[model samples]
Target: MINMHYTACSLLKITFKSLLTFFAREEREDTMPNTEPKLYKLQKKDLVACILRVFAKLVLFSFHRITMEGLEHLPKEGPALLLPKHCTYGRDVALEAIALHRATGRYANFLMRAIASRFYEWAGGIKIARPKDVRRVPGARALNRASFEYIRWLYLQGEVLVAHPEGTRNPYDMGALKMGVIKHLMDVENEAGRCIPLVPIGIRYRGYWVPFSRIEVKIGEPVYADDFENIKHLLSYLREQISQLSGWVI
Candidate 1:
C-alpha cells in the first residue's frame, strides 16, 4: 500500500524532528531557574532549532533544487521581521524555515494558530488566535495579548520573527495581506521607539508539491517604519515587493 522509500523518508523525518523536541526539553531544564514566564525564557542558544535547521536543509536538498538570493538583506542579528510568500501547503514552511536559519545563523520565531501551539512552541512558535477563534473561542483576546507580549520580548531580545502577511497558503497567487501582526509590530515600535526591519521573502516553486522541483527564494532589502509615511503605504509596498519577488501578482 505504501512505497518503502517513502515510508523510510517519513520515519527519518519524524525522528529528526522528535530529536529536536527532546533537545528543546533538555535545553529548558538547563535555562535560568524559571522565574520568568514559561514561554519568555530565552535560551542562550537554540540548540534544537539549529539541529532542526540542518536536518531540514539536508532533507530539502535531497528532494529539491533550492536557490536563494538577497541573503545579504537578512539581518545577522534581529529585531527583524520577515514576510514570505506562502506557497505549498506544508513543504514551503520547512523550506523557508531552513533557508532563513541556514542563511542567518538564527532560529526564527513564528506566529502560528493557537491549536498547533504546543506542538511547535518548543521550536520558536508563538501561538496567536485566529479570526474565527476570536469570534468563537473563549479567552481568545487574552491569549492574543499574552502572545503579543511574548513576541515583544522576542523583539527586545533581538530574535528574528517571521509572519506571513498573506496569513495562509496561497499556491501561486498572492492574496490579501493581514494586518494583525503588522499592527502589533507597529505598536511595539511606537511604544519602544525601536525600528525593526521588515524583510520580504518570496518563495517560488517550479512545480507545486513536486519532488525534485526547483525552489527559488528571493529576500528583499529590509524596510523600516521610518521609510513609510503611514501603515497603509507600508502594507501596499510589502505586497508589491512580495509579489514581484515570488513572480506572482495580485
Candidate 2:
C-alpha cells in the first residue's frame, strides 16, 4: 500500500512538471518575434537622396563636418557585424547608415531597440528590448531571440548587420558593451562552423547637438569570433579598439 501511494505521488509530480514545461514552451513559441518583416530595398534614388542629405546637412548646419577614415576596412562583399559607438540621439543613426551604405554599397540591417516609428520599421530594423527593460516590456526576451535569428539569417545571406552594443547614446564617455549579441554570434559560429567578422566603428563628435559639431567616423580592422579564446576577451578587445577610434577613454 505504501509503495502504491509513493508511486502515485511521483506520477503526480511528474505530470505537474510536464504540464509546466509544455506551457512554458507554448508561451515561448507564441512570443517569438516574426523574422519575415519587410526589409528596405535599395534604389538608385537612395544614393541621390543620401548625397542630397549630406549637402543639406552641411549647408544648414554650416560648421558641421564629417570625416570618414579606414573605410577600406569594411569588406566590399561579405557578412560583417558593425559595432559602432552610439553617440548622438539624432542624425547619428542616419549618418552611420549612410556611411555604411556609401562605403560598402550595401544597405545594412540594423538591430535596434524596440520602436514604433515607421522609418525604422520601413528600414527593416530588427527591434529588441533592452536588458533592463525586458521584464517590464512584454515579450522582450522573445523579441531579442527573434532579432538574433533574423541577424543570423542576414549573416547567411552574406549581408552586413549593424548593432550598437552600448545600448544607448553616450555623448562623451563610453558605455559598457553588451554581451548578448556577442554570445549570439558565438552560438551561431559554433552551429555554422564558421567565423563572422566583427567590425568596430567609432564615431566622435566635438560639439554634439551643436551646429559646429565636427563628426569623425573611424572604422577599425575586422575581428573574428575565432580570433579570441572567449567572449570576454573579444568584448574587451572590441571595447579597447572602439575607444581608441572614438578618442574615448576606457
Candidate 2 displacement at residue 232 in angstroms = 0.6
Worst 10 residues of 1 by lDDT: 27-36
- Residues 1-250 of candidate 1 have per-residue lDDT tens digits of 1244355458656765576466544322311121223556863347656655666677667767889998888888859899999875446667677777667767788776765423366667676777876787777777787778888888888888888899888885898789888888889888888999999989998864456778899999999978889888999999999999999866
Which stretches in model 2 have alpha-carbon errors above 4 Å? Answer: 1-63
TM-score for each prediction? 0.85, 0.75
Candidate 1 collision pairs: none
Clashing pairs in 2: none
Best by lDDT: 1
Off by over 4 Å in 1: 1-13, 16-40, 43-45, 117-119
Evaluated at residue 66, the lDDT of candidate 2 is 78
